[model samples]
Target chain A: MRPAVRQKLKRRFAETLDLPPSVVLDQAVIHIFGDSEVKIVNHKGLVQYSTACVKTRAVQGLIEVGGSELEIAFFSAQEIKIRGRIRQVMLK
Target chain B: MTQLLWLWWQGYLTVRLRGAGIERLLNRASQVGVALFRVERLTSDVVLVRMAARDFRLLRPLLREAVNGPRISVSVLDRHGLPFVLRRFRRRSFLGVGLGLAVLAVFYLANFVWFVQVFGNQALAVEAIKTAVEDAGLRMGIPRSSLDPARIERKLLESLPDLVWVQVKNRGVRVEVHVVERDEAESGEQRAGHIYAKQDGLVTELLVLQGTAQIREGDTVRKDDLLISGMYYDHQGRRQYGAARGIVKARVWYEAVGEASLVRWEPLRTGRRRSRYLLTVGPLTVPIGRSLPRENHLVTSRTWQLYLGTAMAPVSWTRLDYEEVEWETVPVPAAEAEQNAYELAWESLLAQGVDRERVLVEKRAVENLADGNGIRVTVRVEVLEDIGRFSGQ
Candidate 1:
């Protein structure tokens, strides 16, 4: 990605996440697994982690996980952190 | 940029770190008797501490502890404030202040005259002399160091001829002036043109000089008789008068008997030196010196000084005088006692103007008797001498 586009997306993501924009995500390093745990590390230390075993889906304005409940207010972000049993995974 | 970097390095890092090091150094310094306190940060790395120099020296070794790496440095700044700095060099000793005051007091007292007096005559006006003295720079409140008393006295005598002698004495702050007035002559030079016999007797001898004789030898002349006339005729035989003065001596007779106590008291002089200063003010005199060195003694005479009309200084020189007291005793040889009485009678007659050539001892007798005080002696003497004389008539 271009540096400018990356900076704009980082700002928009920080605004959507309600975190300070001054927070540097550039030093952040991400780890992903197809059906395993997810982890993120920044220059300072570990920032986030998740373990999953659940069915996931993303619709136009909502996301559902294993049809346990449909909570529209909980649907947010391109990258989601999950911590539960994963039945399936879907990306819109 | 390099300069700015150097400044930031030196000013900010080195200086500030050195200041911070001062407190730790002082803390280590005060392990002895000194104490450092009230440290405050002046810069990011700079700190100032107040402590005594002894403590600072004691902590000198710990100052190096603050120099850890090349980036850090240490330095020490004296904590004496502005007021202490201003007063540090201006202290004076108490002795110096006291000496200065004493000198000033002496100088002031030296200029003030403490006493003034005028001496010698009572007729001379004291106030007038005082005024003259003041005009001559010898007044009160004038320093003795600057006054010349002799010159003042000379000037005073120059203007007042009535003063025969003048003297001025200065002792410390007191001044004394002595004056003596001139004496007038006696008035008795107006007897002339007459001559009279001094006594009533027959003249035994006569001697004439520059006068007319009215009586000659063997002439029976009464008292007040004109023995010589001063009036004489000139070349024209006219009467001319002059002073009548002559001396006549004639034989006279007298007898005296006196009794003397064999024992008599006489004063003996003892040589001793005693010094005293006499102060005189006008007619008044006061003795400022010692009265007597010996307590149980008699004073025969004393001398004093006058200033103005009063005595301000008194100096007395006293000597021991012994007085012989007479006492009664048993009678001794009458011959010696009679001789002593004769000598005493001769002395007495001589003092009474008995002519030495004609004086004669007729009878010598002494009766020794006991008296309350001493032995007594009685004697008689006969004296024959010419006792007639004539003065100006």
Candidate 2:
């Protein structure tokens, strides 16, 4: 979906249910703990998996995760959890 | 933790997946709803993963998805959980059946009598009672359920009319029969009888239960003398005869003399020793050597044996202890010798049936021997007790 249209639908959906847009939206919610880990929820699937880097397909675009010793702490259709010395998380 | 438990509960398989796209095996397995976990990358072209045992069959067709030949070899590593254990054990069904049959056999055998015991019966013969019990179908090796305790007791009372009271106790695998026999002669009709003195003693108390008292308190009586007369004067001044029953208590006095030598000999160990060992095999004792200890040495043996339950092994180790002892003459003081003689006199008094309890009084005397070679001690103890006996006129 287009970014503008996706934003409008999320806002409307959140307003209709009286809930937070972050919860209603299908966009990847990234949680970064300093340099230790970055957990991405609401993802599509694992596109590339390696020890040094990982590329996950988020609901919006390609989610490139760069870090040292990156391990898939957890992997499922809805969530992709990467742990270990995460240096950067880019969504392009 | 939950993953390990799930693997154990559902049964898992360890397989070696060799290919450049080995990682894809995990992805493809997960896609096929196989739930592969614990993936470890062993090499660039090989990986190991655990999947459900049931999923091993589905992975064969998916081998075509690998980059290389994708050779997969699966060996059953382990089978866990109660269901898998039962499945393996089910192959030998006789073990289960045998265990069940053994339990049932124990239950069935416990209901039958294996041993019968008799108690509290003195005058009644145990063998006669056992025969009667056999007649009642409650003997050894009989079913307890078929025997009624009350009916057996009644049968015993009928067979042996002398039983005043009878009790039957049936326990697991054992039956106990207890009976109290009646004293038919004492309670039945009897002719006249006299109460005589069983021994010489001074009468302390006397009571005639069914006859006239021939002797009163404080009277000295000899053995076989009459204490109660079965012959009594009737109301019309005529002689009559009946059984005599009474209690006669007396204070009996006794004396004993003991002598102790002033110059006596006692055996003392000289500290000289010898030792030997012997082995016993099944009641046959074999000495280790023919060497024996010197003369005048007393030999004592100590043995050690191993036992398992009630059975003892035939192998026994015995060690003999020998010590040389010599009898030496020792001069004993007169006072000590007199004390020793006094103890000997007391022992002799006890041997004559003197009552240790209720001794009214006691006296002792020590005197030098007439030849002046030894000492003599005398002891006398008095006790009050019953001394009545039954006799016929």
Candidate 3:
């Protein structure tokens, strides 16, 4: 399938499950398929989606993500919260 | 303006800053191969950085990155701009530094002298004493630190034999030479002796004032005669030694005759005039007027003094003088010549210290010569007076 259609389907499914509407454009969820990697860019408002794992560039403005278990790493931003078990947060 | 230039040349604006963060900043900049200098950290968040114009431009970008990443503030300063900023920051400190340098310069230029004073003598010259001081290695313009007053006194005494004693003193800037000459003892030499006539003459009169004389009135005596003797014999026939001296008045005679030409050349005054101005420098004078005057006249000169070198006095011009010449003719009469001869004879007697009452004029004659210069005159005179006397005792 097309990466954009896949991203739209994943985002709609997450919203239908009553996770949060913010999850449609605020979440960077990486799904590891068998041979290819998929990044579900939910909260960043990106028009094109990539099928391979890629690093996120610095962005301005606020994006929100809601889930019972969530984890994120912030390098140069403020007010980053992680609700799940903090697996690792390393700074270089 | 001069003061500002002096302050600039003294390296007053050169700033050196030091701190632990400065070392770290320099190391970091060096790692990046950036030519940074004069790095200083005043506080944990404040740092001062200096570099060349090109290097500062290149480091501006990296410095901005460091400011953002390290969360520290940095200021880059040029050499000229640093002094003004630092002066404002520490005004009292800079003023103190400037005053200290001025005081040091004054101390460097000050001249001083250490001297030794010699006193209690009169005949020795002050210059001789100064020469003795110079020989002892103490002289003008020598610093006070190098001179030892006690050592100078010892050396001066060793060098000068005429000085009775010397004392060293360190006056402010001038070495005064006070000297005294050694006094010598008097010798016992006799001052009174026998007086004797220098020539033989007749005793015309008696003008005795002191002591008894052997000769009576109108007695003739020869030279070396004992006119008055202080040798007295006692009743036991022993001669007593004493001072023998006396004055004797005697008659003496001589003759003098003189002849002089009536016509003589004397400088005559001519009513003529000329004036000139001169420019003088030191010993050299250049006349600034015309070389020749309208008439051939005598030139009388006077000198006027100009400026003394570097002294504040008015210029003076004194004219230096001399004269030029010609000859003219004048005539004389025989009566005039005889009168002139009598006048000359009287003047000659007065010049010779002869009493006017003791001279008797007898004859006068005048003769005209063949030359244009006038007549010659001859005069005869006779005088009798007591002319023999003794002068020494």
Candidate 4:
């Protein structure tokens, strides 16, 4: 099947089974704690990292976090935790 | 936090990477399960990361590949955790040996009795109980493994006839010896004895528990006079001898004399005071200042001695305070003199063991001196008390 059709089918299946979209679609689960920290589960990899901004590749697109003194606290195959003054979280 | 602790327990290293493709390096490292943590970018091309020490060796080849392929520089900043700590101590091995020896010394010393304590002993002497315990092979510094508390208790009960029950408790480094003494009345057994008068008194009450009553109530008896006899006749008229036990309450008299001068001389402070110091080493006394005769002065001396640990040294320093006094004669009224004499006489009576609660009657006599300079007083008190003394035959 095509990628678009597969994603549509996974979304419908998640709604029918009462399951989370992230679990069904293999999507990145973003968790923001106030404006200081962000945790991304099922992350792909780090694309670009700097003090003011951190950009990571997700399943469908790229996740960019803009803030001051942004740091990649830790990263594994499963998740990535970013901490600092996270002013904006943009999905591209 | 648990992950951080786990990483620390497994040992870890902080590596600083100076390169342009640090992000790719981190992504590749995480993909291979290297667990890159605390990835902070210092500059555009400089980043610091932390990874487990075990993963560090695996990362070495990857680092060499990165250095050769992408020209990345990897330098370890710090090494932490138990493995590195042990590696550092491998040089100063004597310190570990000393610590082990110290622990061994403590363990060895703990196996010996350091303190021997006696409890629940009122009538029995503590030193006598300790002596008994020492004789029973349980004393200070004795090995705990060699101690037999039951045997010690048995030996203590055997050696001290006064004790009815004994218990020896070995508690860690302390040995506790508890003893219960036999009551005097309860211990009156088959030993033949006679109950005698402890003092001269008129017997007012008598109750005999054993033996035969030799003295009746209201009978006057002297000290050492037999009040009860161990010799008695049974119901079959056969003669028997046993311990004599009885309570003999009596009315005893105590007399005391006191004298007071009518013209009393009082010492008045003359306001002249002097102080001198003296150092005494055993029997030798050395004066620290000018020594003056202590005549006609009230002297108050305080002594301080040097002590080494719990033992006192022979060296001592004394500070003597002397206040000069002058004697002045004051005329005392007869009534005041008689009152003073009475108080003094009563003090002497009380000192002779005359119980105030048991006192039935008191008598005092006052007489003027032959030269009319002083008065003499005599006081007498009678009290009801037990005056029985048992003499074993």
**Which pairs clash inside model 4?**
none
Give per-residue CA lDDT, model 2, range B303-378, as digits (tens): 9964434333435689988788887889999889988899889789889888778689999888899998899999
- Rank by DockQ (best first): 4, 2, 3, 1
Tens digits of lDDT, candidate 1, B1-393: 553333233332112234333323432343334433333345445544444333344454555554572233445544344333334433644655676785565445545466788877777789887777777778767766777877887888887777778888866556788888765311223455556665455566666554566776677666677777776666798887765444444433444444455444343435454555454432345665566634333345544332223323222233333222333345534555556666676677676666667645555555555564323444444443222333454
Off by over 4 Å in 2: A1-92, B1-89, B93-95, B183-192, B197-200, B212-216, B219-226, B253-359, B362-381, B389-393
Please give the lDDT score at residue B68 for candidate 1: 78
Highest-DockQ candidate:
4
Clashes of each: 52, 0, 19, 0
Error in Å for residue B107 of model 4: 4.6
| Model 3 lDDT per residue over B73-168, tens place | 344334444345466548678776787775564344233452345555577666777777888878865776786777777877778766656777
The DockQ-based CAPRI class assigned to model 4 is medium
Per-prediction fnat values?
A: 0.00, 0.00, 0.00, 0.96
Over the stretch B1-393, how does candidate 4's per-residue lDDT look in tens digits?
998999878889999998778888788888888887888888889998999998877766777767556778888999988788777678778887787886566567667776788998888889988888889888777777898998999899889999999888766666788888898766665468999998999999999988899889989999999999988888999999888878999999999998887888788999999899998754579997766666678889999966544434445799999889988999999999998888888788888888889889988899998998988899988999999988776
| DockQ, every prediction | 0.00, 0.08, 0.01, 0.59
**What TM-score does chain A of model 4 get?**
0.94
The Cα RMSD in angstroms, rounded to one decimal, for candidate 3 relative to the true structure is: 34.8
lDDT of 4 at B307: 53
Q: Where does candidate 4 chain B have its weakest 10-residue lDDT segment?
A: B306-315
lDDT of each: 0.49, 0.75, 0.47, 0.85
